[model samples]
Target: GAGVSQSPSNKVTEKGKDVELRCDPISGHTALYWYRQSLGQGLEFLIYFQGNSAPDKSGLPSDRFSAERTGGSVSTLTIQRTQQEDSAVYLCASSLALIGTSGRAGGELFFGEGSRLTVL
Candidate 1:
């Protein structure tokens, strides 16, 4: 893919259901991130993965939220037992290098349109 790609642009589900969102980043990008945006609010960092490094899962809001990156190219975010508060736009981004590092244009990020998840 030329840019970050997210699937199922809109999803409406009942409370307590599970949702899986997918992301395919641009080829050769080394870093991937997951973020959440509530209506009228700013992006909240969810998780981050860097090449061969331990993923930073510190931002996940609860145990029900988890993500995994495989082969350093694709990623998935799964939300279990969805709640109304979990409704939001899930965004995925990729960068060639870590932000603030040398080269790679200061870690420019390419973002996907985002997957909108609604819990009824």
Candidate 2:
């Protein structure tokens, strides 16, 4: 019955540093997602992983952002050479759907409180 869990609820780093954010999804959930929200901005899709399929990285802002889901349970989002513009709330969500198609059909996303990142 556990929901998505994110670690390092808050992080502040110097510009140009590298940071890693972690996420653990609910059991048996085959779909995982990463999103980011900047100040005064709506949530933006970052990446997606479903089952053993290749992750969708189209949403990542640049080459500095990347993510990986291991064993289909835990996922990590890494921002290399963090920049001021990268400061935002990183959110992780999971769903019972095996594919992203479920959300369009009314499937819901269980989200974590989000990890706030700040680059000074």
Model 1: weakest 10-residue lDDT segment is 98-107
- What lDDT tens digits, residue by residue, belong to model 2 across residues 3-115? 78998899999999999999999998888888999999999989888864545678999999989888989999999999999999999988888443634542478889899
User: Once model 2 is optimally superposed onto the true structure by TM-score, how far is the C-alpha of residue 102 displaced, in angstroms?
Assistant: 5.9
lDDT tens digits, residue span 1-117, model 1: 477899989999999999999999989989888899999999998988896353578899999998888898889899999999999999999898776567555349889999999
Model 1: lDDT equals 0.88
Task: Name the 10 consecutive residues with the lowest summed lDDT in model 2.
Answer: 98-107
Candidate 1's C-alpha runs over 4 A off are 52-54, 103-107
